[model samples]
Target: MLARVRRNGGTAEEFIGRSGPGVQARVPVVTSEGANKVQDVRFVGLDGPGWLLRGTITGTGAVPGSTDAWSCGMRLVGR
Candidate 1:
């Protein structure tokens, strides 16, 4: 599985982790844009068999930009 965060003119941080009964690992993320910051993400699995990922990100560069985006709902890896 792959996750990505994109910004208009600034950089983005990245973090990857595995959540399951027998899976525990931290993966590194690579960035393609210049001066883009990247970091590892941390997530916790809930008691109801669900994973929750939360983090904060800051944006830089000129404001007042417009863009369209699409997203998929969170899903459990294994059930």
Candidate 2:
């Protein structure tokens, strides 16, 4: 998954164990012919009895190894 992102001109960081078994990527936000904009995005997945959850996060909450309230809360829930 990380390779795929990089291959397409994006950067990714993977998180594991206590923080995540997920990926955070900074990908191009433009598809046009001009200068491309890059934005950070996070992808997280969780599986429980007969159900699965996948989340995509953006904005300020997408900081890598984030220590904010929302990021902390998510880590607790994921565990």
Candidate 3:
């Protein structure tokens, strides 16, 4: 899974175990007109449940290891 980040020229580092080793990556998203945009991405997979949650934050203030958006996501996903 980490390879997916490296393949896009981004680095993937393991989380601090707050959510069971979630993935942190800052990857580039290519635009239609031959442009590149860097995006902060995080992914957490549910063990033994075949479920995965992926999040991407863009625009200003988007960064790796940030939890604001993730918190919002969890709320949307429910408890």
In terms of TM-score, which candidate is strongest?
A: 2
Q: Give the lowest summed-lDDT range of ten residues in model 1.
A: 61-70
Model 2: per-residue lDDT, tens digit, 27-69?
Answer: 8777577767988888877787998878787887776767656
C-alpha TM-score for every candidate: 0.21, 0.71, 0.59
Runs in model 2 with CA error above 4 Å? 17-19, 31-35, 75-79
Error of 3 at 20 (Å): 2.9
TM-score of 1: 0.21
Better candidate number, 2 or 3, judged by lDDT: 2
lDDT for predicted candidate 3 compared with the true structure: 0.61
* RMSD to truth, every model: 12.5, 3.2, 3.9
